[model samples]
Target: MSKISKLFKGSSSSSSSSSRSKHRSRGGPTPQEAIHRLRETEEMLTKKQDYLEKKIEQEIMVAKKHGTKNKRAALQALKRKKRLEAQLTQIDGTLSTIEFQREALENSHTNTEVLNNLSFATKAMKKVHENMDLDKIDDMMQDITEQQDVAQEISEAISRPFGETFDEDELLAELAELEQEDLEESMKSMGGLPSVPSSKLPSAWHGHRTTTKKRVEEEDDMHMLASWAT
Candidate 1:
């Protein structure tokens, strides 16, 4: 009887330990409760997934509206625009410098042409003046040569004798008397000379006076010779 009581106590302790182990193995909940907890966890995870997807979609939409799909792409485009702007500014500066240099070159060319034309004109004028001076000098030399020839001819005529036996002084006086008579006749035929002498006359004529007496005497001598011969 003692041995059977000990065996029953041992079996009761073993059964209690087994029941506690079985309860602990089920995680202190029923199968239906576990299923409900799993469903709740699944629902929360689904809602979080949906919220994240919607937020991602909204971000994509915002990016599309702003014209870029990503931050890096947008930054690259901005940098490209800045570079293009800098290039355009540099090109404009180069063009401005070229235009200014072209204008200056044109002005310099124009000034050079003007200076060349002015120098040519000045040279031409100087040549013309020199030619005119040479022409005037030639005219003066010709006039002097003509006057010398006339003077030589007059001197030769004055030294020649009128007849074979006449002295030079008597021949010259007779030629002078005849020239005076002929000049008076010519003046009378041309309606006579002015009472006042010409300003251009030689100074030797200023004191001279003449008459037609020698002409009348020579004419009477010629008539007497003609009568005697008849």
Candidate 2:
């Protein structure tokens, strides 16, 4: 019993000493130190908050100035930007997946591996056709130029015959002479009208016959008178 009491007394003393030591080690800070630490923390937090606020204000001002023309447009642009950012993230993920696939393929040693690949042959053909079309356009332009030159030459040739004036009187005289010649040729081909001739012979023949008959009758009367006188 006495040993147990001694042990309890020792434990109590040690605990009391440890408590007093802990109490003595704890000291009060100066007002200035406390205030300075608080002030420093506050200032740092304030500066951080201020910088964030300024950045937000600047972003707002920039958005107001040039982000969009109107509130609705600005909202739409923000939404669209968010959608684009999401699409970009998705594209990045897809590109990362493609890179990983490519790395895996490169690491593999199989010669008969199948892969999805894009062929640029069509695009190259399209470019070639575009260049060809451009060349054709140039050729068409040259052809047009040549045609214009030919047209100009033809125009010059046509204009070379007549200097500035035309002879109106000479043309009119030539037309009149042609018309007169045509008229004279037509009249000569159509001949003139014919005429008849006259004759006189029947009346004289009948009168001579009557005279002979009368002479014959007178001769007969003279013969009868000579016979009576004889």
How high is the CA lDDT of each candidate model? Answer: 0.60, 0.56
Q: Candidate 1 local accuracy as lDDT?
A: 0.60
Candidate 1 worst ten-residue window by lDDT: 205-214
Candidate 2 per-residue lDDT over residues 161-207, each given as its tens digit: 65577699998999888766655554455452222225543777657
In candidate 2, which residue pairs clash? none
lDDT of 1 by residue, 1-230 (tens): 65435554665576567557767997565434434434443444344445445545554555455565577755555555555456555545655665565566556667878999999999999988875677789999999999999999999999987966857998899988876676556546656443554465444544333334456546655654454446
Error of 1 at 227 (Å): 65
> Model 2 Cα displacement at 217 (Å)?
99
TM-score of 1: 0.30
